[model samples]
Target chain A: MNNALPRWVDYGLMPLISVIVAFVISGLVVLFVGESPVQAALLMAKGAFGSGYNIGFTLFYATTFIFTGLAVAVAFHAGLFNIGGEGQAYVGGLGVALVCLSLDSVFPWWITFPFAIIAGALFGALWAFIPAILQAKRGSHIVITTIMFNFIASALMVYLLAGPLQKSANLGPRSRDFAEGGQIPKLGGLFRPLGIDMGASPLNVSFALALIMALVVWIIIWRTRFGYEMRTLGISPRAARYAGMSEVRLVVLAMMLSGALAGMMALNPVMGDQARLQLDFVEGAGFVGIAVALMGRSHPAGIVPAAILFGGLYQGGSELAFDMPNITRDMIVLIQGLVILFAGAMGSLFTPAIVRLLTGVGVMPK
Target chain B: METILQLLDLTVRSAVPLLLACLAGLYSERSGIVDIGLEGKMLGGAFAAAAAAAVTGSVWLGLLAGIFVSVLLALVHGFASITNKGNQIVSGVAINFIAAGAAALLGNAWFNQGGRTPQLQSEQRFNPIELPLAETLSSVPVLGPTYQQLISGHNLIAYFAFAMVPITWWVLFRTRFGLRLRAVGENPAAVDTAGISVSWARYRAVICCGILCGIAGAYLSIGVSAGFVKDMTAGRGFIALAALIFAKWRPVSAMWACLLFGFLGAIEIRYQGVALPVLGVVPVQLMQALPYILTVVLLAGFIGKAIPPRAGGVPYTKER
Candidate 1:
C-alpha cells in the first residue's frame, strides 16, 4: 500500500472523520435517552453560538482548554504523557489563591496578576518536578507517578481549603473572595465601550493571555534549541544521545514546561471567573486536554480550533440538559467520553482504509 | 484490644475490593495488556449489579449481570488494544470516562433518583454469615474471639477475595495457561512461535480480569453498601494498579500490599477526629493521601525497582 498521502489527509481529514463518527455515536446515545438527536444538535449549536452571552461562555471555557491542551501537546512532543495536569492545575489554583489573598489589599490588579501567574507556574512546575525527575533519572514511568500525584493533589487541596483557607465567617470549604484590585476585569466590560453588549459571562483578559501562551508555545517548540533537543529525545533517545543531547535535562525541562502551561489554566477559572479559590475549580479540563491534543495532532494551530470545539460542546451540552429534562448532565459526559474514545484511542481506525483509497486514486505519490 | 480487632475487621472489609481489583489487574498485565481500566470495569459492574439487584431483587442475578457488563467492557478494551493496536492507556482512560458518565445517565433515567440506583432490600443484598461454633467460640480466650471477629462473621465475598490470592498464585504458576500467559507478556513473539496464539492468551487473561473486576464491583455495591454511587470506585482501581506494581505483579504479594492500603483506609475512617501521640491530630486528608504518596515513593525506586513485563504496553505485530 502506498503511504505517501498528503499531510492534510493525515492530520486534517482523519481527525475530522473521527469527530463526525463520534458525534453520530453520541446522537444515537441521545436517541437512546428518548430525545431527538436533531433537536439536541440544533439546540446545542444555538446555545453555543446564538448570542454574545453564549459565545462569551464558550470562549471562557475555550481559554482554559487551550492552556491545558497546550500543556498536553508540549509534553507529547517530548514523548511524555502528563496526566497530572489536573493536579498541577489544582495546585496552581492554590498558588493563585495564596498570592491573591496576601497581596490583594496592597497591590493593584496588574501588580498582583503577574505575581499570581508566577506563583501558579512555580507551584505547577514543582508538582511535575518529582515525576519528571523520577522518569529522567530512575527509569520510573511518568504515567503512574503523575496519576498518583493527581490524587495526592486533590487530598492536599481538600485539606487546605477546609482547614486553613476557609474564611472565618463561612463554614464552606473555599477561600474568602479576592479584593477588588486582584480581580481581573471581565471582557464584558471591555465590549461595552464598543457599543456591543457581550452580556454577563466569565470571559476575561485571560483568554487573550491564553492565545499569547499558545503563540509562545509554537515559537518555543518550532524555533528554540531546547525544543529541538526535546523533539530529538522524543523521536529517538539513542539518536539524541549520539548527537550529544542530555536526555535527562530535556525530559525534566519539557515536563516542567508542560506543568507550567497546565498551571496557567487555573488563571482563567480562579482569577478571571471565580474571583476566589474553590474546590474542583479545574474540573475535568485536564482530562479533556488529552482529547484536544490528540485530535489536534499536538500542534498549537490545531489545538486552538480543537479547544474551541470542545468548549462549544461543553456549553451547548449544558443548554441541552436545561432544555430537555430526559437528557441529564451525565449523558453529556457519556458523549464526551465517546468522543474521546474515538478521537484518541480509535483515531487510526480509518487510516488504513483511507490510505488504500487515496493510493488507488493516484492522489498520493506512489 | 477490641479496638484493634475492630480495626482489623474494617481493614479486611476495605481490603476485599482492592484485593480483587489488584488480582484482576495481575491477570491482564501478566499477559501483556495493561488493564488501567480496572476502575471503569469495576464502576460498570457496580452500576449493573446495583440496577439488576434493584429490579430483580436477587443478588445472585445482579452479580451475573455485573460480570456480563464488565466482560463486555473487557472485550472492548481487547478489541481496541489487541486488534486495533491502539494505545492501551488512552483506551483505559476513555473507558473510565464512559463508565462514569453512563452509570449516572442510566441510573437517573431508570430510577429517577438523580444518578443513584434504588437502595437494595435486605433480601437483595449480601448479609454477614455467622460461622459454626461462633457463639461457643466467643466465650473462649484470644484465639476464639479473634477468629470470631476477624474470620467468622463477614460476607461471602471477603472469603472469596482471600481465597483468590492463593488461587491466583497456583493458577499462574502451576497451570499450562498460566505459563503461556506469563510468556506472552514477557515475549509475545516467542509465545507465538511456540504455536500458542498470543492473542488468545491475552484475550483469556483480560476476560479473567473482567470477571475479577466484576466481583469487586458487585462486592462494593451489594456486599459493602446497599447500592451504587457515582464514582464509587473512587480511584480504587488506580490504587489497585499501584498495588499490582508494589507487589511486583505477584499474586501473593499483591494481597499483602492491598491489605496495607486497606489498613491505611481503615485508619483514615476510624481516626477521623482522633489525635495520636506523636502525630497529634492526624488529618484525615493526609491519611487519604498516604497510599498514593507511598505508591509514588515506591515507583521512584525509594523502596525497590518495579520492572514491568518486557513486552508490556507494546502492541504485538507479526510483520514487525
Candidate 2:
C-alpha cells in the first residue's frame, strides 16, 4: 500500500481531498435548506478568520482539540479506540475544580496551575483505567466499554454537579465561581505586546502547552522503545504475543497516556476560559477528536493542523448560526461526520485511483 | 395490583424500541458486519417518521419515510465497509454522527421548532388499539383487567415487535438465506467457494437491519410519543446493543433481555423519588447507569462468555 502511494500523498493530499469532498456534501445540505452555500462559505470564512477575536476563539478551541485529538491518536497507535474521551474530559474538569476549590485561595496562579494539571490528568487516566484493564485482562471490547463509559460519565457528571457540587441551591447544575488565582489570564494580554491583538479572547497559555505536548508526544511515539513495542502490538497482536510483549502493561500505559491528554483538555476550558466549572463544557470536542485523529492519520504533526481546521469550522459555525436563521451549529457537526466518513471509512476508494492516475501520468513506474 | 399492571404496561412500551433495535443488531452481526450505527439509524428513522407524519397526516407514510431514510443510511454503510473495504467501526461511527446531526439540522430547518416537528394529530400517530372485549372484560375477575391493560390496547407496532422475535429466529435459523447469511459471518471464504456472493448476502442482511431499525425509530416517535424530540432515542440504541450482547445474540434471549431492561426502566420511573430500605432514595442516574455498567460487567465475561461471530469486524479481502 505504501509502495502504491507515497507518505506525502497519503498524509497530505488524501486528507485535503477528503475534506474538500466533505465540504462539498455539506454545501449540498446547505443548498437543501434554501441557503446559498457559496454565501455561507464566505460567511464562515469571515466568521472564522476575519478578526483577531475570531482567530483567538479558533485557537482556543484548537487548544482543547489538540489535547483530545492527541488523546485519540495515542490510543489509535496502540490499536485501541478510546471514545470515552468525553467522560475522561468531564472527570478531568472535576479534578480541576477540586484543585481550585481547595487550593486557589491559598496558592498563586502559577502554583495552582501545576496541581490542577496533575489532578486533571490523574483523574482522567483513572476514569479510563477500568476500561483499559477490562480490555487487557478480560477481553471486553474496548470500543463498547469506552462508549458505555461515556454514558456513565455523563450520568456521573449530572449527579455530581447537580447534587453534590452545586453550592447554590437556586443555580443550575454548576459550581461556585473560581477565585482569581484559579482563573488563568487570557493570551490576549500576552499577544498584544507582540503586535497580534487577541481582543478580549479566551485563548490562554494552554495553546502553548498543547504544542509542547505535541512535541513531547512526537518524541514518545517515534523515539521511545515503548512506542516501538506499542506500535508492534497495534500492527499485529499475534506477533507481539510471540515476542512476549506484556499486553496488560502496554495497554494500560497507552490508555492512561491517552486518558491524560484528554484530561488536559480541561485546562483550556475550566481553567483557561470559563471561570467556573460547569456542565457540558466539553460539549462534543471529545467526539470531534475522532474526526481529527482520522483526518490526521493519527500523527501529531497532522493532528495539530487538523485540530485547528475543525476549530475553525466550529468557531465559524457559531458565527453562521447568528446570520443564517435556517442553518445551525449542527451543520458543522454534519461536516464532522462527512469528514470521518470520507477520510476514515471510505478512504480506500481513493488509493487505487490515485495509483492509476500517477502511473498514467508517468509520474511513477507502473 | 393496578399500579403493578400499569408498570407492566409501561414495560411493554419501553421494551418495544429496544427489542426492535436488538433484533436489528442480530441480523447485521450474524452476517459478520458490526452495526454500531443502529443508534444513528434509529434516530434518523424517528425524526423522518415524525416529520413525515406531521406533514402527511398519515401514520403509514411516516413509517415508510422512516424505513426509507434508514435504508438509505444502511446502504451508505454497506458501500463504505462492504464495497470499499474500509473500517466498519469507523464507518458506523461516522454514520452515527451523520444521522444525529442531519436529523437535528433538518428538523430545525424544516419545522423551526428547535429540532422538533409539529405536534402530531391523532390521525398522524399510531394510537392505541383497544381489543374487542377490553372494555367489557375490565369489570370481571383477575384475568379481565389484566388482559385489558397488559395484553391489549398497545399500538400495532408493539405487537409487531413481539411477533418479530419468533420471525427473526425463523429467518436466522430455518431459511436458506439465513444459512447463507450466517455462513458469510462465520467464513466468507467458504461461502465464496460455494459460489454465493458474500457481498450480496451481507447487503441483504444490512437492508433487513435497516428495516427493523426503521420500525424501532417509528415506534419511538409516532407509535409512543406524539412527536419527535431531539435525541429522542436517548441512548436506547446502545441499550439495545447491550441487550443483544446480554442475550448472546440470540433472538429469543434478546426479547427477554429487553424486557428485563424495560422492567428496570419502569422501576426507575415508579421509584424516581421514592426511598428504599437499604439504598435510601435511589438516584435516577444510578438506575440509568445500571444497564451500561451491567453490560460492561457481562462483556468482561464475569458471568458468561459473549463471543462474537468468528469473522465479525474483519473486512473480507477476496485474495486473502
Candidate 3:
C-alpha cells in the first residue's frame, strides 16, 4: 500500500480516516442500543481526562499498554508476531508474585523492585524461549505457537493460583497481598510536596519506568547493531543470510527481548496497582498490544501515543458503561473491536483514495 | 465395557463440532484464505441459532439464521482480505473480538439473561435420533451394543458431520471446482492464467467454510446444549484449527484428528478428579491444556512438517 505520498499523510491522515470511520460505525451501534452517541462520547472524554484522578487512572492503564506495545513492536521489527505477550505477561506476574511473597517482609522496596524486574524478565523470556526455539530450529509458525502458549499460560495460571500460590486463608484464586516494602510508591504521594493534588489513583512510579523502557526500545531498534541486523532479517531473510547474519540467533534473540518486555508489563499491575497476583491479571492487554503495534506502525514514538489512546478508550468506555443504562460493558468492547477492525485490518481501505487525491493535488509524484 | 461405550459415545458428541469446524478451516485454507475467525463465526452462529429458535420455535429457521450470520462474517473477512488486500490474520482476530462483543450485547438485549438465550424446548432442538431397529439390534451380541452406543443416538447434524469427511474428500480431489480451489491455494497466478478468478474461488470457499462453521455452532447450542452461553465455543474453533493442522489438511485425516482431540476432551470431562498410577491425581487444568500443548508440540515438527497451503495467508493481487 506504500505509494508516492508524503510520509505524514501516509502515516497520519490514513489512520485518522480509519479511526473516524470506526467511530462513526460505533456511533451507529450505540444508537441501535438506544443510547445517545453524543452523550456517550462526551462522557468518555470527561471520564478519561476531565479530572486529575481520571487522568491518573488513564496513565496507569497506558503504562501497561506501553510495555506490551513495545513488546509487540520489537517482535514486529523482527518479522515475528508475538501473540504470546498475554501468556508472557501472565508468567511475568508469577515472577513478581514470587518475589513479593518470599522477600517483601525481609527486603526493602528498592531491593525487591529490581529483583522482581529481573525475575519478571526471566520468566517472560523463558515462556517465549520455547516458541522461539521451535520457530528458529523446527520451522514451526510463530503465530500459532504464541497463540497456543496464551491458552497454556491461562491454564497454568489457574492451576498455580488454585494449588500452590493460593493464599493460605483466602478461598479466592489469588496470592496474598504484598508487604509495604514490595509495593511501589503511588504518583499521588509524589505530587504531595507540590501544590497540585494527583488524587488516589493507581498511577505509580512504574509509569516513569515505562517511559524509560520506551526510550530504551527506541535506541535498541534504531541505534544498535543488533537492531540493524534484525531489521535486515525482517526486510529480507535471504539478504540477511547473504550478509552472513545468523537467522537462528537473531530470531531467538529478538523473541527473547520481546518476551522480556512483555514480562515487564506485569510489574505495573502486580506491584503498582494490584499489589497481589491474580488470575487473568494480564486480561487482554497483550492482545490489545497488537492493535497498538499496528496503529503505531511498530515505531516506538508512534506506540507511545497509540497506547495512550487505547488506554483512554479503556478508561472512558468503563465510564460510559457506568453512566448509561442501555450501554453495557460489552458495547464498549464492541466499539474497541470495531476500532481494531478498521484501524488494523481494513487500514488500506482508504489509502488508495488518499494517495490518488494527493497525486491529483500535485502534492506528490504519481 | 459399559464405561468404554459411554466414553466412545461422548467422544463422538464432543468431536462433532470440532469435525465440522476443522472441515470449515480445510475449505477456507485450501482456497488460500487462512481463517482464525472460525471461533468468532461459530460463536455468532450459536447465538443466532439459539436466539432465533427461542423466538421462532423452529430449529430449521434457527439453523438458517445461524448460517446467515456466519456467512455475513465470512463476507467481511473476504472484503477485507480479498478486496482490500489487508492482513487476513488481523481481520480474523478482529472478527473474533467483534463476535465476542456482539454476541454478549445482543444476547443480553434479546434475552435479558446476561448474554445467554432462553433454554430451548425439546421439540425446538435437534434431539438425538434413535436409529430404527436399535432395540432389536440390542438383542444381538458385542456389535449390537457398539452400534447402539456409537452411532444410533446422535443428532442429525452429527451424522452430517461424519458424512462431510468423505464428501469433502471427494469434492477436493475428484471434482473440477475442487481442483480449481486447490490450484488457487497453491498458485493463484496459475489459476488466474488458466482463466479462473482467484477472488471468486476464495469467496465461494469462504462462504462454504461459513456454512460448515454455522453447523458447528448450531450443534453446540441446539444439539449438544440447550442455549447459547457467552463465548460457548470456548476455543474449540481454535482446537479445530489445530486438528486441521494435525491432519495435514486432508479430509479423512482431519476426521481422525478431530476424533483424537475429542477423545482427549472426553477424558478431561469424565475423569475430572480421577487419580492415575504414575502421575497420581491428574489436574483438570492439565487435561484442559493438553490439546493446546500437543498442538504446540505437533507444530514444532515433532511428528512431521505440517505444511500449509503454499499461498495460504497471502492476499491475491492481480498486479502483484
Candidate 4:
C-alpha cells in the first residue's frame, strides 16, 4: 500500500479503466444495433492510426489539446476553474488572424508570427482578467462568471465572423485565409523521406512549441515565487495574505496566465495549423479543457500525456464511424465522460476504508 | 398596442422553461450543491421527452418519462457529491459531459437525424389552452386586451410555471419539510443534532430539483417547440443558474430573473432579421449573448453578494 510503484499503478489505473468502460459501453451500443463490439473497436483503432496520415492528423489535434489542457491545469492549480478558455481561445484566434491578415504585407513571417502569438496571448489574458478582477474585488464566484463569459465570447465571435471578418470568397461565417507569408511551413514533407506524408495534417512547428511550453509551465509552477503565491492562494487565501502575498494581484495574474496559455491553443491551430477561423471552430475545447484538467489532476507534467490521450481519442473517434458504421465517434466523448466520472468518484473508492482504518488507528478520535 | 400585447405573449411562452429551470437550481443550490449540470439534465430531459413522445404518441407519457430520466441523473449527481464527498463542481461537470454524449448517441441511433427527433403532429404535441370566456374580456379597456392575449393564451405549462412561484414559496417557507431542508443545507451537523436525516433531506431536494428540470426540458421540446435537437437548450440552464444567484436562491425572485432572461431571448430571436437603424442591424448572435453578459455584470456588481449555504457541498457522514 505504501509502495511508490503501487502509487504509480493507482495513477495509471483510471485511464485504463475508462477505456475498458468505454469499450463495454460501446459494446452494449453495438449489441443494441446488432454489431460486434470487438469488430467496431478494431475498426476504430484502424481508422485512428492505420496510416501515416492518420498518425500525423491525430498528433495535430493533440497539439491543440496540449495547449488547452495546460491552460486549464495551470488555472486549476491556482484553485480557479478557467472554463472561459473557449472564449479566450476564440478571441485569441481572432487576434492572431487579425494580426496575420494585416501585417503580412509589412513584416516577414518570423517577426509577424511572434507578434501574432503575443497579440493572441494579450487578448486572452484580458478576457480572463475580467472574471479574475470581479472575483477578487467583489467575491463573485469564478464558475458562474467564466461560464457566462464563454457565451459572450461565442456570440461575439459569431457576429465578427459572420459580418466584419467574413471571408470574401466564402459565404459562411468564417474569416479569410491567412496570407501565404503568414502560414506555418510544413515539416511533414521533411518527414516524407522516412515514409511520413503529413498532407492535410495541421501539425507543424506548433506541436514542438506546445511541448516546450509545457516544460516551461512546469518550471514556472514548481520553481517560481509567483507560482508559490498562486498555489498558496489556491489552498488558502487567508494564509497567503498573512504570508504577505497580494491576493488580488495573484488571482488576476493566475487567470491572466491561464488565459494566455489558452490563447496559445488558438495559435497552434490558426497560425501553425488551420490558417483560418470558422464559427465554432474550436469545437468546445474550452469545456473539454475541464476534463483534461481533472484527468491531469492540475499538474503540468501530468497534462502532456493526458492531452495526448485525448488527442488520440479525438483522432481515433473521428474515423471510427467511417470504418465501422455501428461504432460512432461519440464513443470517444463517452469514454472521456466515463474517465471524468471515475476520476470524480475517486473519493468513493477509498474514503470508507480510509476513515475506518484511520479511526481504528486512533488518528481520528472518537 | 396589439404588437406590444403579442410581444408580452411571446415573453411568457419563452420564459416558462427558463423559469422552471431556474426554480430547479433554486432548490438544488439553496440546499447547498452547485448544479452546473442543470444544462445537461435539462437537455437530457428534453431528449427523453421528445423521443418518448415520438414513440408513444402521447405528450403526457413523454413528460413523465422525461422527468423520470432527469431524476435518475440528479440521483447520480447526489450520490457522487452527497455520498462520496467528491467535489460538487467536478461531479456536475462529469454529469454534463456524460449526458451530452450519451443523449446524442442514443438520439442518433434511434432517430437517425444526428441527435434530433422527428417533429410531432398537432394531436401528438401539447396544445395551448384557449379560454372562450376571454373573448368577451378583450374589449373592456387597456388592461383587458393585455390580460386576455398575454395571460390567457399560453399552454398549460406556462400557467404551471407561473403557479409554481407561490407554490415554491409556500413549500420553502410555510412547510416544516422546507425548514428541515434549509437547515440541512446551512448546517447539516445541526440538522443531525435535531434528529433529522441530512442525507435524506438533501436527496429529496435533489429529486425535486430533477423534477423541476424535467418540467423545464419538457416545456422546451414539447410545449415550446415540436421536436428535440442537439443542444436545443443552449445555455438557458446557465442563465437559470445565474437567475438562482441573482434571486439569492429565493424561488419567487428566481421567477422574476428568469422572466428577464426569457424576455431578452424572445426579443433576440423574434427581432433577428429586422434592421434597426439605431442599432445598425443588430446581429442575432450579439443579442443571444446579452443574457450572459448581463449575468456576469450582475454577479460581479449590481446583485451585490449572494452567499451559499456554509455546508452545502460537504457530504454528511454520520459520526458514531
Candidate 5:
C-alpha cells in the first residue's frame, strides 16, 4: 500500500529487521533457560552447516516448507486464507501411501513416482475442494472452514492409520514400509563428485522437484493470465466482480491449486524421507508455511530463503537442544512466533520509520 | 433417570469452558476485533494458572495469574489491530504460536516435567463446593436429587460461569458502556462522530475478552483437571468461536448454543465405545471431529446464516 518505499526496503529491509528482532528475543529466551546465548548460537551454526549430513537434513526440511509456503501464497493471491494446508498435506500423504502400498511390490520407483505425484496432488486438491466450494457457493468464510477441515483431516488420518492402512496390531498406527518402488533415492550420491560425504542424510530428488515447483509457481502467479486474475481477485474483490470475473471459479481454482501444493508437501516427508504414512507427519508445517509466505511476501524468490532459514532453525535448534537440555527445539518455535508477530502481524511497524529514514536520506523525494 | 441426570451434569461441566470462551469472543467480536487467538490465549492461561497454582499452592493466585496472562495477550492483539492497523488474523495467528511456544518452553524450563506442571493437591485446586441444604433435601420427591446433582455441587468457577450469562446480558443490554461497545462494532464512524475514541473502547473490550478467556483456562486446569497438560485447552477455543457464530453473537443465545454442543460432547464421551446397530462402533476420531464439522455445516448455512458484526476484523482509520 505504501508505494513510496522501494522494493528492496519493503521486502528485503523489513524482513531483515523482523528476523533480527526475532533472533535477539530468542537469545534472551536461551539465556533465561540457563544457557549461554553466544554458545547456543555457535552450536546452532555448527550443527546446521557443520557436515554434509546436516546440510542434507536442512535441505530435507526446506523441501517440505517450500511446497506448503507456495500453497499458502497461491491462496493469498486469491483473497482466500487456506488454513487447511495441514489437512490437505495429510490427505495428500494418504494418496501417496495408497499409491506406495499398492504399487510398491509391482513397479519400481520410477513407475510409482509419477503416479504418486498425481495421487498426491489429486488427493490434496480433493481435500481442499470442499472448503473451496463452500466458500465460493455458500459465502462461508474460508478461514473458519479451512481450519475446521484441518481437524477433520487429522481425525480422518487417525481413523485410516488405525483402522485400515495400519500394518498390524503389534506395531504402531502406521502404514507398511514402502519397498524399492516407493522410496525415492536420496541425493547423497549426487554430492559424491564434490568429495563430500553425505552421511545418511534424507535429502532426496524432491529437493529438485521443490525448486522446479518454485519456478513453476512463479510463472503460474506472475506470468499467467489465470495468475493475473487471481491477483486481481485478491487486490480488490469488488473490482474483479465489476470486471465480470467469475468470483466462484477463481476462488475454487485458487484454493484447489493451493491445496495441491500443500498436498504435494507430503512427497518430501513421506516418500522422500519416511517412505510410509504416519500420524501427524505434517507436524505444523502448514502453520509454518503461513509464517514463511508472510515473511516472503508470498513470492517464490523470498519463500525459498525463508524456508531454508526455518529449516536451519529446525535442524540447529535440535542440535542446541541436544547440547543444552534446558533449551529445547521450542526456542526455534518461539523465534518463529516472534517472526510471525513482527514480520506478519506487526509487519508494518517499521514501515513508517523506514519511510521517514528513506526520505531523510534523499532516497525518495517527498 | 440417574444416568440422564449424570449426563446433564457432564454437559454442564463441559459447557462451562465453552461458555466462558464464547463470552470472551462475544466481547471481542462485538467490539469489532476478530480474535482468532482465543485458542492461544486459553492455552497460555491454562499453563499460567496451573504453574501458578503449583508454585503458590493457591487456586485464587492461579486464577489471577491466568487472567493476567490472557489480558496481556489480548493487549497484544489490540496493539496490532488498533494501534498499528496490522492484519488482525495474522496477529491472532502469531499470538497463538507465541503463546503455545512460550508456554511449553517456560513450562519445561520451570517445572522440568516435560512441558507439564506438577499435579496440584486439593488445596491448590478449585474443589467443588456444595450448596447449603443440599444434603438435607436429598430425600424430596423428583426435584431433590435433580437440584442437588445438577444445581448444587459445581466448583466456584462453574457457578461464576453460569452467573456470568445473566451478568453479561445485563451489561450488554442495560449499560451505557455496552451500548457504546456494540455501536463501535456496528458503525465505528458513527461512534467516532460522537467524539468517542474508538481505540480506547476497543482496548477495554479486548481486555474484558482476555479476562473471560483467562477464567475459562483456569477452569479447564484447576476446576476440572488436576494440573496443566500441554495443549490442554485443545480445540475448545475454536469450538467456542464456532458457538459464538452459531449463536449469532448474542449473550443468551451463546449459552444455549454452548450447552447444545456440550451435550454433544458429553454424548461423544459417553457413547465412544458403544457400538450402534448399523455402525459397528463409533470411532473416536469421528467424535473428535464432530464439533468442527458441525461448525462448517452451520457456516454453510444449512441451518442458518451466521452474520458477523459489521466492521469486524477491519482496523479503524479516520480516512476509511
Candidate 6:
C-alpha cells in the first residue's frame, strides 16, 4: 500500500490530477456565477468536439500554443523565465506582416512564406537577446526585465496600430490585411481524398510543423553538448562556469532559441491562417502558453497535450457562449487560472509525503 | 505656480494607495516572503468593498469587508509559502491570475455590466475631507500653501496612508517581533536556532501585508473611484514592488519612492488635456507608458545596488 501510493502518483497521472483540481475549483466559480457546473461542462464538450469543424478549430488553437509552450519550456530548461513571449510573438508577427506587404508581388508563395518565417525568427531573437544579454552581463534579473518587455511591447504595438499601421479603410485601430498569396492553404481539402474533411477548423500544416519542432526541441535538449551545458547551467550557473561553459553565450543562445520558437507561433495563426497581422492576431496566446508550459512541467513533448487542452478550452468556451446565454467566454479564462493554481501548488501539496514514502523503500535513494 | 500647487494636491491624493501598498510589500518582503501577490489581494479587497457598498449602502462595512478578504488572501499566501515551502513567485502569480479571473467571473454574474460593477452614489463612496484649519493657515506663506495643498485636502484614507509610513518604520525597527522577522528573512537558520519559528514570523509578516494591501485596494475603489473595474489594479502592484526595491527595503525611503511614482502618475493624467502649445496633442498612450518607462530607467540606473534578501525566494524547511 505504501509503495502503491508512490506508484499511483507517477508522472502519468500528474496532468490528470491537475485537471481534476482545475475542474473542482472552476466548478465552484460556476456555482458562484449561478450556473450549473455539469451543464456548463457538457456545453463546453459539445462546443469543442461536437462537429469536425470544432475539432479543426481546436487543432488551430493548439498549433499556436504548442509553439509558445515549446518556447517557454526551452527557457525553463535553461533556468530562465522569458515572459517576453508575448512581446516576441508580437514583434515576430509585425516582422512577418511587413515582409508579406513589401514582397507579395515580387516573390512566389514558397519564397514569401520562408521570408516571413525568417523575419519572424530574427525579430524574436533580437527581442529576447536584449534581456538575455542584460541578465548575463549586468546581473539584471530576467523575470523583471522580461515582464517589463511585455508592457513595452504592448505599448509599442498599441502605438503602431493607432498611428502608423492603422488601416486606411477600416476606422478601427488595426493594421491593413495582407495580400491573398500570404494565406496558408487549408488541409481539409487535401485530406478529403480519404473522406476526412475536418470541417471549418483552421488547423493547417502548422500543426504538423509544431509536432516536428517538438521533436527537434526534445533532441536538442536531451542529446546535444549544448543541451548538457544548458541543463547544468540551469541547475547551477557557478558549476557550469567552472565546467568551462560560457554563461554569457549560453544565456543569449537559450533566449534566442526560445524567442525563435515563440516566433513560429505567429506563422501558425497570424501569417498562415489570418494572412495578416491584426492587433488581436495572437490574442493572448503567448501568456496562455505560460500556463501550458507550467502544466506540461516544462517538457517539449509534454507541452503538446497541455497546449491542446487549453486550445480546446478556448475553442469550446467560445462555442458554449454562442449556444448558451449565461455561460460567457470569461469562464475559459477562469479555468485557465484554476489549472495554473493547482499545477503550481501540486509540487508542494504532495511531493514531501511522496518523497518520504518512497525514500523508506528500496525504490528510492535516501 | 497655482497649477503646481494643484498638481501637488493631486499627487498627494494619488500617492495614498501606492504608498500603503509599498508599506505592505515592505512588511512581507522584510520577513522573507516576496509578496508579489499584493496586486491580487488588492483586487480582492477592491471588489469586495465595491460589492458590499453597492448592496448594503454602507461604505464603512464595505471597507471592513475589503480588509477581511485581503487578510484572508495574505494568510493563504503565507500558508503556501511558509508552511508548504512552495515557490513564492509561482504562488503570487497564481494568486494574481485567480484574483483577475475570479473578479471578472463574479462581476459578470452579479452585475451583468460586462465585467464591471454598477457605479455607486457619492454617499456610498468615501469622499475627501477638507481641514477647517486650512482656512486659518491660508495666509501664512509658501509653507502654508504647501501644507494646505499637500496635507489638508485628501480623503481619510490618504491621511491614514501617510500615517502608515512612520507606523511601519516603528514596527519594523523598534519592536522585538520586527527584529525576529527581519532576522528570519536574512537567515532563517539563525532564527530557528534562537527558538523562534521561521514559518510563524513569516506568516505574521504576510498578514501585515494583507491588511495594508486591503486598505490600499479599498482606497482604490471607494476612496478614489465609485466602482470596480476588471484588472483595475493595472500593474500598480509591480510599481509597489519597484518602489520597495528603490527604497532598498527601508520603510521611510519606500514612502518617498511611492510619492515619486505617485507624482509621475498624477502629472501624466493631468497633462492629458492641458498640453504645451509646442507639443501639440499628448497621447494617452504616452502617459500610460510613463510609469513603466520610469520603472525601467530607475531600476536600471540608480537602484541597481539594491539587493534582495539572501533567502527571499528559497523556502524554509524545518528539519525536526
Scored against the true structure, residue A231 in model 3 reaches a CA lDDT of: 93
Candidate 1 Cα errors over 4 Å, as ranges: A1-3, A190-196, A360-362
Q: What's the true lDDT of residue A144 in model 3?
A: 86
RMSD of each: 1.6, 1.2, 1.7, 3.4, 1.4, 3.1
Per-residue lDDT of candidate 3, residues B11-91 (tens digit): 999999999999999999999999999999999999999999999999999999999999999999988888887878889
Tell how far residue A210 is off in model 6, in angstroms.
Answer: 2.1
Error of 1 at A134 (Å): 0.7
Expressed as tens digits, the lDDT of each residue in A1-366 for candidate 3 is 575657897677766777678788778878886778899999998988877788788888999999999999899899888989999999988988898899899988888999999999889999999999999999998988998898999999999998888987465899988998789889887666765466888998889988999999999989999999999999899999999999999999999999999999999999999899988899789988887887777888878898898888888877877787566667656666666788888887777788778879888786
Off by over 4 Å in 2: none
lDDT of 6 by residue, B175-279 (tens): 999898889889999999888989889988999899989889989998889989987888788778777877888988888988887887887778865766898
DockQ of 6: 0.50
lDDT of 5 by residue, A55-162 (tens): 999888999999999999999999888888989999999998899999998999989999999999999999999999999999888888988999899999999999
Q: Pick the winner on lDDT between candidates 1 and 5.
A: 5
TM-score of 1: 0.97
Give the CA lDDT, 0 to 100, for residue A252 in model 1. 96
Q: In model 6, which residue pairs have backbone atoms overlapping below 3 Å?
A: none
DockQ of 3: 0.75
Report the Cα lDDT for residue A183, model 4.
75
* Error of model 6, residue B22, in angstroms: 1.9
> What docking grade does candidate 2 earn?
high
Model 2 lDDT per residue over B136-255, tens place:
989999899999999999999999999999999999999999999999999999999999999999999999999999999999899889999998999998999999999998999999
Docking class of 6: medium
Which parts of model 5 are misplaced by more than 4 Å?
B277-280
List the global CA lDDT of all models: 0.89, 0.92, 0.89, 0.79, 0.91, 0.80
Clashes of 6: 0
DockQ of each model against the real complex? Answer: 0.79, 0.85, 0.75, 0.65, 0.81, 0.50
Model 6 regions lying over 4 Å from their true place: A1-10, A191-199, A352-366, B135-149, B273-287, B301-304
Candidate 2 lDDT score at position A38 = 99
